[model samples]
Target chain A: MAKRGMLIVLSGPSGVGKGTVRKAIFDQGGNDFQYSISMTTRKPREGEVNGEDYYFVSKEEFEHNIETGQMLEYAKYVDNYYGTPLKYVNETLDRGKDVFLEIEVNGALQVRKRLPEGVFVFLTPPDLMKLKQRIINRGTEDMETINKRMTKAVEEIRMMQDYDFAVVNDKVENAVESIKTIIKSERFRVERVFPEYEEMLGDK
Target chain B: MAKRGMLIVLSGPSGVGKGTVRKAIFDQGGNDFQYSISMTTRKPREGEVNGEDYYFVSKEEFEHNIETGQMLEYAKYVDNYYGTPLKYVNETLDRGKDVFLEIEVNGALQVRKRLPEGVFVFLTPPDLMKLKQRIINRGTEDMETINKRMTKAVEEIRMMQDYDFAVVNDKVENAVESIKTIIKSERFRVERVFPEYEEMLGDK
Candidate 1:
């Protein structure tokens, strides 16, 4: 039988370049793994595909999945629903391909409860001052919104201790290298690699 | 203040090439750390140093250390004594240098209890057949002793699950690379690098 693929939860504070690091890891060749595409009740944005970008569905369909427990975890945001689908994640892992879920701290924690063996990685900035600069450089939010995000960032960074690994995003290449190292090391964990060995020795 | 260094325990069945991989790591210029030299009452062989190799000591001295709680763990083997010194390990760690302790599974477990943060890595041969070949290649034992060592090897391999990481010693270079990856990833643990951030976030 094929070995099971690892489930990885990637979480970080807003504007810490988590998306960029995730892109770099994929760009450096992690195509064997699946990037989980979440489902949402919100309308598809311009150029976004219904099933590829997200499994965009109506409110009724989303509520139905939630009721049937098909959703791994879901949250309502600004009158729209967003969630991870359990079916796709299970299918992807069963196919012997690892799955990456880029999620917020809360969502990652919820997933951790369901998948205890899942690897949770927290991406962090070098320091708080650098984080503030990166957030303002985006120019996507006013000072009030920026302040709120900074507050949330502090809270998220605190939750980093709950993570299995932390990659400091001072440099994108360095952060990607750290993440790659973690993935490789996790693959060598005895519980993940030696179940057959355990059984064979048990019989002896 | 300088950050604290991690304690790393390296354990494997005899002749799994743990020594060779460790030497390669040091030879490849990764010696910013210290290797913990264990103390023993066993007589020094030819060319072995008093302090540099094993801390060759008298039986009384070994027993005295055990009574005084200076040793981390002690074992009586073939009418001789051996144990790890807690002082040297703590001093090396306090100097912000990672320490590698080459030990058996039992000794590794004892150290782990004392240093709960230590990383435990179990190295293994590719298979039992290869392990027997490696032991025979050492040319230090007769057939009877070889069989005895092989039996011990199987028993040691069974305890691999207690390790945090395991590397199959199929090739020297590959095993060294795997160990390097484990060290790099371990250094990125959130608690090790981001304690202040965790405290400031008020989530601790």
Candidate 2:
């Protein structure tokens, strides 16, 4: 089998532009990486394709996967279950493609607990004010909701120490480039390389 | 004070083209990294500079620095003392310049003991046979000496697990690029960034 790929868990406070940065990374063709397809119980929205956007599944199927231990991490939100499926991630990694997951802090923490070997990268805005501005610009949340999100973002940013890497989302392109560099370096980590190549040096 | 710079320790088996890769990195202007000059008790060879090539110091001076803990790591070789100067390295780092030390396995291990936070990178040839060829092509060693060096190289390469990262010296430019990415990514480590900028979010 090819060498296993890195499980890179990217997390950040809300409105840190994780989605924008992720899209930029893909558009740049920075490296050979696979986006983890989340299994969600929510119905597919317009233009959303199954397995590309998410593995849209029935609520019962999602629960079954969780019970069978096929979910790396899962969370229930407003009667919908969303989670990272272990089957696809493991297969992609076995195929020698780094797996990328964009998750929230709590979900990232859960993945860390289960797989400490995964690289946990926390994304943050240049500052809290910038994060607030981003949320305001979205125009999807009310003033009260924005205030609540701002408070939550503060709490999440404060927990960055738990992450392996912290990147500032100052510009989408810069953030994408930073993450690409990180993944490239991570592939060369000693522990990750030793397992596959150590036996070849048996004469030593 | 400026942000503390990274301590990058580069090591590899002899004849792995470490010097070539190092020069390539510098030539490419990969990043702002300072080559650490060693303090040596050995008399300067022809055309070697005092502060640039090596800080050719008196045996007494070298011993005094070691006794005063001004030497980060020192090794006595053939009645000559060679070591990294703690004072110079600390000053460079405090000035926000990453210090790059190209040393052998023993010296790298010593530095790792004294400073666990240092980034230790081990460069390896694509394979043992390739390494032997590189050593033979140098034209400085006889058959017996070349054999001994090859054996030693195997031993050192086996200890690559002690390093934080490893790069295959397939091509000089590739190895240089690998190190550059590692250095770039390491600057974003959570432990390094959190202490410096976490407080900026206090008002949030």
Candidate topping lDDT: 2
lDDT of 2 by residue, A1-204 (tens): 567888998888767888788777777774688888788999999999998988999999999999999998989988999899988888988887789998877889889998799898888777654564556476765778777867776676678878999988887878888998899999889998877655434433
DockQ of 2: 0.48
lDDT per residue for candidate 1 within B1-204, as digits (tens), equals 456789988888767888788878777984566888889999899999988879999999889899999998768879998889989998888888899888866788788788889889999877753554455476766778666756775676677877888888888899988988888888878768776464444421
User: Which residues of candidate 1, in runs, are more than 4 Å off?
Assistant: A30-32, A129-154, A201-204, B128-154, B198-204
Candidates, DockQ: 0.42, 0.48
Which residue pairs show backbone clashes in model 1?
none
Candidate 1 falls in which docking quality class?
Answer: acceptable
Tell me the TM-score of each prediction against the true structure: 0.82, 0.85
